[model samples]
Target chain A: MTTPPLPQWTALARDAVFTDPTEMLLKADRFDQTIRRRNWREYAAGVSGVLLSIGMAAFFAWVGDYAIVGAVMVTGMGFLVVMHNLRRHASPVERLPEEPCIEHLRRQYRYQAEALHSVASWYIGPLVPGFLAMQAAIFWNAAQDRGWEEALTDKGWPFALIVAFLIGVIALNRWAARDLRRKLAALETLD
Target chain B: MTQAAEALYRQAGAQFAPALARLARSVERDPEKARDLEQEMHCALWISLARFDGRCALKTWVYRVAHNVAADHVSRAVRGPQRVALDVIETLPSAGNVEAETAEALVLAQVGELIRRLPPVDMQVIVLWLEGESAADIADITGLSAGAVATRVHRIKALIAGHFQSEPAYGVTA
Candidate 1:
């Protein structure tokens, strides 16, 4: 192997990269500040998500007939946001700088893959029970206006629309799961 | 633990600062970004030392961390543009007009640029070998088998030999 001597590259690096010793000494101090800032940003986004979910729940609850569906959605969105924020911002590896790079990469991939696959649990699953309650409530609330048979028959098309909507939500989650699975499979090759 | 980590940081940082700088410089073309990467490398070393169990040689550990950081920096930089394989690069021609006086510097810069474009595994081995690491050391740092490092080193040598114009006084030049 006739490898060219790389003195020029080394020289260029030495000239360009070497800094005052003080800079090296103070790196940890600066890193602390960066970490604090990042943490603040993460918490801020999470708080906003919680607040938005509350607002959504409140607005939908005010709609009377759609109150149950709205509450379920609020719960679902809140759970998803909280779990996602935790995974995205508060990764253990970010603080554990000593962890090998390959380990870090694998950790990140693992988190993302789990997050993607969990759309049903933290996201869609939370909505399922609440959604069923909401549908039952919709029929009951409609029944107060007329006879039970009248309410059921009259509300048929609207109930069909709501069922279609829920199916669509699950389908979208499945699509996301499939996409994440592909990414996870690709990432596994590196491990 | 803090004092031990700090002492180790200073010791390792002093020893490998030059190599880490070279790694960062190889990854980033912009001086400002390279400086930032260099600082990041230092910070990483300090944090990484807290967990340094000495399972591997200190030199191997440092490059593992340094190259990982540099590769991440390079990956971020390359995300905006399409990257080609090294084979594609091999088919391309080298610049022919660099004067002997400036040929060395230009070649070094071009080599750094070429390195920045490579995939992470290839990039890591090539960077360590170019920086004068032995095959065993490269394997230690990269977690690749010794045979793998030898094969990669061979390929890198051939790649460089084919692409870079050589002079009799390569590293001896001013």
Candidate 2:
């Protein structure tokens, strides 16, 4: 026997209520705009933080104040730690269907893991260097204000500390990105 | 976007809106939820319009976006307690126009319920098939190869046929 043609009339009856598409189209546009605005807001926040860091460095340098510079360094480090923790702890936004086929579910999870890894790398790769550069500029400027001998002797310990901190930050960022990627890859291979 | 892009959006909306609504209703199983999904899909499509590089037919792209939106909305609804209150419980006429329409609606509703029970990929294939999408179009929308779509279509049809045959009282009237 031949297979039946699809019940086109039945489908049409089901959709009888939604005859107008204009409203749907408009709502879609509005949602798109909202998402775009959200992304812009996140970008603005990041730019603002970077600007504040630069501003603090400049203000402290003009006043030859190591105390204020030290405070700013601590504040910047604290902000980075908070932002990193918040990002790391964020829940996955897209939830999978409850009873998806095993194969399909696996594929979906793999895709998500890959995406998360991409995002983590995208964030960490530039963040480490940018963070270190800002810290260096601030510390170096404050040290230079003193006479050459005094600056060299006084700044040696602080400069060494900053270098160590930079190395640690870069290593930590790279490790976090790589570890997340590896864990996600492992999830893809699980039963 | 240019005027041509804007016109395309308008034209695509006019041409595909009814069909998209039908597809959403079939999968969503609730009217209010269907409307919500439709709105979301429409919004996504418009936003994604700029990225449409003419690599695929406009209809195929619209269907893919609509299917994704409906799937996402339904998943959320199932997980949440906000049980979609049956939209106003539409009244059906008792005779002639209403009778035929009601019979048709009942059949479609049963079909929709059955389709919902299938695996997501299979359900998508069946819906696309019912929408008169070609194998090639289904492949494009699904990111599956043409051969894979054809195989899945055969398996899905047999599954639906078996389901209707086994559950005689489930609206399979002579």
Candidate 3:
């Protein structure tokens, strides 16, 4: 069947209409719903991580008798959560503008790109001090149990591996940031 | 749901619900997903009302919000490299004032199928054009220049002409 002439589409377009969004509009705390829907997966991951850390922290406190270190980890997590919540509530993401769809898209890409680029600071950096203190506590405990030289010999490679892994993570985040920058630049060029 | 924001949202929603639904249909082939996208688009529109600020026409703002939400949904739901975000589009009413899905339903279905095959950018421009938006309006909504909208409209006309070598029932004579 051949389609109607172009001018006739406007009327036909109404056939597939969505009902008055009054219900949604009236009771729709849409931002809350949207934020919940969009970020639930991320929140799940975070909750799991927190639970695991709690287990680890308890082990450190009771088994390892590393109360100071355990306290640091738990407290740091609390601080991180509070900071995250505060920031999220303070300045929500603004909506898409009316200029053009492409511009709105690029703005979104740019936001994500910026977020990924700053992950080390907002996401990871907060944990660093606590983690380093924990590491030091572990070494101190190990050294007290074994002679310093023996502890150094025994733990040296593992410590070295961990430091290397952390470095690798930082490098990977940086690379991802650069990649996003390139993508954002390309999106800008399309305008 | 600040009262002011809700007031603006209700007004926009009433005025442009059709456009929002069509925008969702264009982006998503799956009906369920289209429904979800439509709701999400409405929600986005509501939350976004606070930022409208009278900078652009209300129609421009509505389409921009709807299309942007649709684009974002396509990326998130599809999880593929962003191939152009396009979808099926309807055509204009003739001087005869054809209802959107009258006897023309079959023809429109065919046109929708054809339009769906175009890249999202072209699909969007053609869809807007078909909806009787001015070239300037299409340009504003799609972020294309007037020249670019003209070019895409030209391509769409050619595409339709190819599909209907014989006379089309609704007067889309090439």
Candidate 4:
């Protein structure tokens, strides 16, 4: 197979690099929106967890159930621990150093690897433990006064809804995992 | 953040955005995928911005982020069997002021097909070169030594030259 001429290659490169005006701006705006939305979701979830714990504790205290209050505290504390662990494990962003050109690219590849790994951890870390802890709490609370069937029936719908939500969350997590894995593999090919 | 830091990011974005986007297009071969890569790079850059201590040129930092983002994308594409094929070179539309749009399109199509056949690294080198990256800059972005960059460029040029020698009517001789 003969190689194409320089002019042809140059022309091809020009076409490849040239941006469509509408598409370029639209992409930038869309990217900005995605970043904003992702940040908002994370913030909202964090706030919601804290609020839910506080509300649960207060409601239990008002009803004079010290035991339930303690449980709520444990749950709240567990959530905080998970959050702290996540923060600790989060990758630190690299500072670019003044360097010769080749060094810069090498650093860039290293940074990319770090960032991809960080994202992968974020996707897979909490779901399993968090799901188990919540389920255990539900069962423990329900078991205090009645059999499993009785407890389930009394709050079956809500429990069922929670189960459904967990399933949905897991499914979404799997999809994300698959996506990240693909990206990581592609990076490996480059190196 | 210092004024200098913020200004650095803005400058980095302006300088690196097009080249990074072009790289994404070459690797991903789909506009939508290219857009996704761009956004991911933008987010990565924003996250990493705080660590910018004026140690390196902002352009290099941005390219590093862009390359990482693209690498991640390529990895993901590999694991997903449903990913579109990488034979995108055959589909690229030609540029330049040709009188007949069809001829332009055909030339572009052939060029794209040939490009896809090159090794991935060569593809990257050629694409970056076409984007006006100097050999030194290409070495930096690609993590290859300068000598290696020259060698790869020489090989790529020869390959393109040979490809056109056999198809003269295409007017693609190097």
Top candidate (TM-score):
1
The residue pairs that clash in candidate 2, if any, are: A28-B43
lDDT of each: 0.64, 0.57, 0.64, 0.56
Fnat, model 1, is: 0.24
Winning model by lDDT: 1
Candidate 2 shows a clash count of: 1
Model 1 lDDT per residue over A71-147, tens place: 55656565665567556544543544344444545565566556655656666665566556666766777788897
Q: In model 2 chain B, which range of ten residues has the least summed lDDT? A: B84-93
Q: Please, what are the lDDT tens digits per residue for candidate 1 over residues B1-174?
A: 387877776677667787787777666767788878888877767667778988777877778878777756664563533454454566222434534356566666566667766666667777888777777777667666777667766765665555445644453321
Query: Considering TM-score, where higher is better, how would the candidates rank from best to worst?
Result: 1, 3, 2, 4
The TM-score, computed over Cα atoms with residue i paired to residue i, of candidate 1 is 0.69
Q: Which docking category, incorrect, acceptable, medium or high, applies to candidate 2?
A: incorrect
TM-score of chain A of 2: 0.39
Q: Can you write out model 4's per-residue Cα lDDT over B1-174, one digit (the tens) per residue?
A: 455655655676555666666566566656687667666666666656667766655665666566655544654465322333233232333332434455445444444444444434455566666555677777776666777668666665554444456566655333
Instruction: Give the chain B TM-score for each candidate.
Output: 0.83, 0.72, 0.77, 0.69
TM-score of 4: 0.49
Q: What share of the true interface contacts does candidate 4 keep?
A: 0.16
Model 1, DockQ value? 0.28
Ranking of models by lDDT: 1, 3, 2, 4
DockQ of 3: 0.28
Off by over 4 Å in 2: A1-4, A8-10, A13-108, A114-191, B74-107, B163-174
For model 3, the superposed segments whose C-alpha errors exceed 4 Å read A1-13, A29-92, A96-99, A147-176, B1-16, B46-56, B81-126, B130-132, B150-174
Report the C-alpha lDDT of model 3 over B1-174, residue by residue, as the tens digit. 577766677677667777677767666767898888888777777667777778788788877777777766754663432343232233321213324454345446555554445544566676677666778888888887787778777767765665454645545643
What's candidate 2's i-RMS value? 7.8
Model 2: per-residue lDDT, tens digit, A48-113?
776797688679878886656665655565566546544554434443221222233345445544
